[model samples]
Target: MSSPSTLSPWRLSVAPMMDWTDRHCRYLHRLLTRHTLLYTEMVTTGALMHGSELRHLRFNAEEHPVALQLGGSEADELARAARMGERWGYDEINLNCGCPSERVQRGAFGACLMAEPQTVADGVKAMRDAVSIPVTVKHRIGIDKTESYEFVRDFVGTVADAGCEVFIVHARNAWLQGLSPKENREVPPLRYELAYRLKQDFPQLTVAVNGGITTNAQIAEHLRHVDGAMLGREAYHHPWLMTTWDETFFGDAPAQRSRDWVEDEMVRYMERAHAEDGCPWYAIARHMLGLRHGLRGARKWRQVWSDHRLKPLPPREVWAMAQAHVCNESDVLVA
Candidate 1:
């Protein structure tokens, strides 16, 4: 297994979704694909500087090639945050410039940073100077209907000049006002062409496209234009799509495993996490509900795992109840 530095780590990745791509979710994704890069949910600089380090930075060792996404606009703060991420063993430090939530706007960061390209450049330079690891940026194509391609192009050029090599471009405008974050994701028109054009202009940089990309065929098509493609909610809801990514994208041999095998592995992880810190099984179990996606008995299997009535049961018992459905046994508990 080559280090992410040794290989192109951006080829196929899961987007850094807030409240969704936690350590538990990342561990599950790693089980299904060994090569795809994973990202931590956006962690603000203040959280790392003022909050619990272990709570914000801790991740499973299995989630190698994972990048830490920092949400901040201050150069000094971002540099300090990047250093902490490096010291904690993250493969890369990514600056988030593409979130449209009002809370983020009040903090003076996220998608609003797109309007201040020089500030982003200074922060990128600060992080690059502070850490030996790679520093990357994820940004939107435009913000609040500033649809000119020049806006994003100049943003990328300015940041690239700061020695940042990777840019993950979400091909949508972020409407900063009158739109909830959920609505922002749905309402923005996808202009993948701008991202492709970024690659054409900045031939020296590695650019990955995101937003509205779901299927493997779409990923393959985007790869023809950009260096990589990132999946967000689609990857979260139907993660089994990643089971074939290595073989299809990286040309590795198919994994000789089943959803059952992956579920068993997660059960072991849940048990261990519980024994170590009293973490509940349901917490970890929820990340794997989509493991049996599209397969026969998947709904029943999911129902058993998610059943609130079974919260008090040990994870191993829940696993048994979920497996009973797959094995054609009629005596197990059901939601």
Candidate 2:
């Protein structure tokens, strides 16, 4: 655990998506962007305290600057979980207050907690007291039908008073009732201005905008107003977008690996997983389906890699088939 200043700047990050930002997925994302901070899928205090700790907390050393996003409302429980995250070597501990899922609501956490700003503040304080690492919060602009800017502004004020320094604001409302999580993401129109306003009003606090940002241009635009920009599904779906993130956003040296090289590395990784960890290649390959996105013959290449029949074969065989499909398409186009 260290001071916020010692932590890497949250210039760009991948949102903590459930069932998506697994350790394997984070490892692949790290291959593309060396500087962007990655987050673990939201892990609840109950799961970490009662469930298998290693399964829920383990990650690769390569996934540096990764934050562990925890979902829970109890101050003591959250503090305990935050301590565990620090023990596990996570760079930051983020409390999730923006999730709209019914499952999260049942846990008395997530977007529902936004209504209890003081409780969230208390939890933030407890975690800060428990861990030396930076403690942050991610929440929506509003909950349910509340559209007033004052609501979120006050929430930030209360939490900041409790020692949380960085706030990741999802620029949308979370409808706890009626709307599913998917609808919550789409139905709530993005009001990035609210996030920008937060930064303006609270110049001392770090504010990062999330929601409806898809392209690098949009990230650049948001960075002008806020401290960081967080990408959700878009980063997972089109991972190549991150290939240039290190250079484009963080001003790091350009990534040297080409798409082919990345794929080859993944193949070797899959082979190692199969041999040492007994992991199935398809399980690893699913995350890479979008690797060839927007390229010539990309769909056909993906189909080849996704074919279940190839599961019995080695990763190299699958890679060969995918490459052969792309080459055949190129030959046809040349003619």
Candidate 3:
């Protein structure tokens, strides 16, 4: 491991989701589990290059041990963007080559870059040279129909040579030309065996598996073969699943929070959103909708806050509604 201090000891992490894993989501996950590494939504080099500081890069320092994921192909541009991440106290810089969105393809990045491993190697090298923090890669096994495991094997070999010590592999093919980004996430068949093989072949690099990983058992199984696991949709939809991660994966102190306590914590965060310009309380609350999943009255809890009529209510009041729903469930069951 290149500077194990720079990388997360948690090993298990949350993937860099597009719209779903924003600052608010990251904050919520951080609250649930103290040790799991979190990632920012993939911020393009163009956005970081020309956009406002607060909009493009501002994040609460509480969201530390966080990696800032970047989408770009230019070496110099990525290097400059990486330095900005370092300045902003981001723990790692991750290059994205797994996304299959058309917009990303148009930009000559994302899964399309899989065909250009040399460019990715150059970008990784440039970013690695520019920042003291670890520069990592989150990518797919192959693009389109190039299903050969050797292809991914070589991709890791080439990039790993450039000092990119960590690889978060989405264990699936990206049908770059035909599938919509959402479809790409689903339609492709997963080949986890290949990811395990990559880990075996490249023992020196920290290989983490992503894509459709949901349960603690699955994580433990993958960890047997690979160094880590990255959760995506599962973490977003049932975030409470992360409650065990500290003790289960990272070997840290368990987070001391009840469901009610978590709702209370949201009230404080909501106040922060209200004080900050451009942050809507709902932007933060939307991520919390899943916080109550599988609990009694979760539907009422979600419906109460998700209702548009509730939109005009104050942040504290919205949280109050969620609390009331939880209380109501307890009352009914007790009766």
Candidate 4:
């Protein structure tokens, strides 16, 4: 409900996952925490330039404080994409240099660009020149087995010189050759101290640590060293973790939406989506399966919502059935 510009840029954020963090997913995230900056899935420059702008760029206004993560190496193309992102009203534009997918490497971008800091700086400069909104960079600490802190320090220094004030550092090396994208995330050892050192060296730049951050306690620990912490898989799998972020991390009041209240709001969203856009309930429901994560009857509640047989039923009906698993006997009887 508040203006995004008023919020701190690097206090907390969700990572720009490739398949995850779509607009619908972001909308669900927004309902949980109003202040955490959310990022769109990495959109390649080719896709933004050649594909449907509306399909790739359109987002709900409620997903404010959202950043568009662009994947590309070309300075001019990235600049053009940044302009489109600004025009679409995104609060920030982040360039992706941490993704280790072979597909991304083939495009001459992603983690591969870490070896070419000058090229990334050129791209960052172009985008910064093109858009007035904050232009940030998300990158890995090193590539392959290079353990020198200097590699990442220089990369940050180069990009910062190009006007990138914020750097979301994934504290791991991106092994481009042997590992799959999923493996890249797990196999690489996280060296959070490298990220901390970056903050120490570049005291003026806003440095946020990513990779292996799962809990609010860990986030608190990272904040003592860096400007922020960015969560990825953990946020998607156990999304309720975000509900407490505003109060715990940002010092806001307790969240106004109880778990039950959030469920009800999502039901209303599903109803509106079905009515206005003919959007399938399943598309939206998948994002909420983790809402009850770690709670009693959570698995059954997820099962009820995920059941394809319930597709013919209204969203309210599906919601009622799911609530039956988690609600008290009296509440079920009332329903």
Find the candidate with the highest lDDT and give its number: 1
Q: Could you tell me how far off, in angstroms, the CA of residue 261 lies in candidate 1 after the best superposition?
A: 0.5
lDDT of each: 0.92, 0.91, 0.87, 0.90
Compared with the true structure, what per-residue lDDT tens digits does model 4 show for residues 209-313? 999988889998998899889999999998988989888877777677777888888889888878877888888889888887766778799999989999999
lDDT of 3 by residue, 180-266 (tens): 888888899999999999988988888999998989999999988998899999999999899998777765567777878887888
Model 1: residues with Cα > 4 Å off, grouped in runs: 1-7, 327-335
The C-alpha stretches of model 3 lying farther than 4 A from their native spots are 1-10, 327-335
Worst 10 residues of 1 by lDDT: 326-335
Q: TM-score of the candidate numbered 3?
A: 0.94
Tell me the lDDT of model 3 at 151.
93
Query: On residues 1-335, what C-alpha lDDT tens digit does candidate 2 reach at each position?
Result: 23333544788999999999988899899999988899999999999989987889999899998999999999999999999999999999999999999999999999999999999999999999999999999999999999999999999999999999999999999999999899999998899999999999999999999999899999999988998999999999999999878877776678778778888988988888788768898888889888877767887999988898888998898899889856422233322
What are the models' TM-scores? Answer: 0.95, 0.94, 0.94, 0.94
Q: Write the per-residue lDDT of candidate 1 for residues 26-110, one digit (tens) a residue.
A: 9999999998999999999999999999999999999998999999999999999999999999999999999999999999999
RMSD of each: 3.5, 3.4, 3.0, 3.6
